[model samples]
Target chain A: MIKVQQKDFNYSLEVAALSEGNHDVGGVCAFSGLVRDLVGDKHIDYMTLEHYPGMTEKCLAEIEAEAHHRWPLEKTLIIHRYGRLEPGDQIVLVAVSSVHREAAFDACRFLIDFLKTNAPFWKLECTGGDSKWVTAKDTDTQACDRWLNGDKKE
Target chain B: MKILYFSWVRDRIDLGNEEIVLPENVTTVEQLVNWLQSKGDGYASAFADLSMIRVAVNQEHVKLGHPIGENDEVAFFPPVTGG
Candidate 1:
């Protein structure tokens, strides 16, 4: 499942839902991304996330499907929030369930990595008096590429 | 055809989306981008650097050489920076 929303999500509820009704699953990995308070040396008061209305959902679904194809995950969930958010607010969540821990761990990491590059979302960081659009870091793109080359580094 | 812009591209272009009728010869994304650059100052500056921009046809990422059609929706934006 994949969700893109303006409202905040419940982490415990979502993790439990992923782990529920599955006795055979030995591990469920969940990763949550938070808005950082600083961009380099500047303190970010808040951030406004913007996304292409119809395209964002389609891109996220494609990422989720690719994760399932690459790993042995029994279930997967991705939830991302948009609109204005505080420094400590939750930005995204990726949870994966599998019979073993390796698949769950690897797939959960892969989902977040791909989401950073593949999803059509943009972030604007606001300071006290000014704001700027965040650009994609070279490192982030390289992280996503590593997976495509079959180089998994945990 | 519909064209959409996002992020800094939208801010620079000062417009989000618009509908246009093609000339029936614009076959690839590169040709359409070149045509848009000639429309006005906003588009010219917004698309000043082709390397810094990314294009998508029908909501999927595509290169400049990707083929486009009259009914397709094409979007232009900067590289993604969200998770």
Candidate 2:
């Protein structure tokens, strides 16, 4: 499942719904991202997220498909929120369920990592009387690129 | 053809999107960028650095050398920063 929305999601509800009728599922791993109050020393008042309407969904589906292709997975869910968000708001959720813990854990990490670099969403940080677009981090791209080289860091 | 801009590219260009009939020579993303640069200072400033821009044709990411059709939807934006 993939969702791109402005409304905040309920993590517990989403996870429960994911593993609801699956008795074969042994473990579920989930990751949720939050909006931080501060970036470096600057206090962020709020953030506005923007995305390409048609392209964002397409990229997310491709990322999810890639994760499925790489691992033995039972179920996967991705929910990313956009629009104006305050500090401490949930920005994204990625969850995976599988027959064992190993696949669930690795696939969950892979899903989020790929989404960070591939998804077409942009964030604009707003401070008091000032605002700027969030710069893309090299670390995020590096995190995604490592998966392609068959190098999984322990 | 429809040219779409996002993030700082849209801000710098002062327009979100526009429709234009492509010139005969503008057959690739590189040539399209070069053509757009001649529009005015806004486009020139937005496209000052090629490394700062990313392009997509018909909603799919592509390189500057990628071929573009006459009716394709081309978008220009910065690198993605989503999670």
Candidate 3:
């Protein structure tokens, strides 16, 4: 499942919904990303996330499909929030469930790594009445490359 | 073709989306960018640094040499910063 929403989500509720009818699932891995209060002492007051209405969902669905193709995942969920958010607010959640712990862990990692560079979402940081659009870092591209270099299964 | 821009790319170009008939010579993404730069000052400035931008042909990331067609949707934006 993939969700793109402007409202906040309850972590517990989302997880419960994922494992509701699953008896085969032995382990589930969940990752939550939060907005930081400071970006190298800049004192971030808030951050805004923007995405293309139709294209963002399409990109995420592709990524999720790729994850399932590579791993034996019983269930997976991706929830990403757009619009204005303050410090300590949750930005995204990636959860994976599998019968084995290894599949759950690896699939969870792959989902986040791919989403960082592949998804079409932009972030703007505000501090002290000024805001700046964050640029994509080369390090992020490098992180995504690890999975594609040789470990790709499909 | 439909051209779309996002993030600061849209801010610099001053528009989010526009539909244009691709010239006969603009058969690739690289050619399309150069053609857009020639149309107006906003496009020229927005696409001043080609390496700083990323392109997606029909919602999938592609290189500058990727082929484009009249019916395709081409989007331009800064490198993705989302998780």
TM-score of each: 0.97, 0.98, 0.95
Model 2 ranges off by over 4 Å: none
lDDT of each: 0.93, 0.93, 0.91
Q: DockQ-based ranking, best first?
A: 1, 2, 3
Q: What lDDT tens digits, residue by residue, belong to model 2 across residues A9-90?
A: 9999998877898898899999999999999999999999999999988988998898888888889999999999999999
The candidate, 1 or 3, that scores higher on DockQ is 1
Q: Considering only chain B, what TM-score does candidate 3 achieve?
A: 0.96
A-chain TM-score, model 2: 0.97
Q: Write the per-residue lDDT of candidate 3 for residues A130-154, one digit (tens) a residue.
A: 9899988888888789889956433
lDDT by residue for model 1 over B1-83, one digit each (tens)? 99999999999889999999986778999999989999999999999999999999999999999999999999999999888
User: Which candidate should be chosen as best, given DockQ against the real structure?
Assistant: 1
DockQ per candidate, 2 decimals: 0.93, 0.88, 0.85
> Runs in model 1 with CA error above 4 Å?
none
Instruction: Please provide, for model 1 over A4-103, each residue's C-alpha lDDT reduced to its tens digit, 9 standing for 90 to 100.
Output: 9999999999999987988888899999999999877889999999998888899989999988888777889999999999999999999999989999
Select the stronger candidate by DockQ from 1 and 2.
1
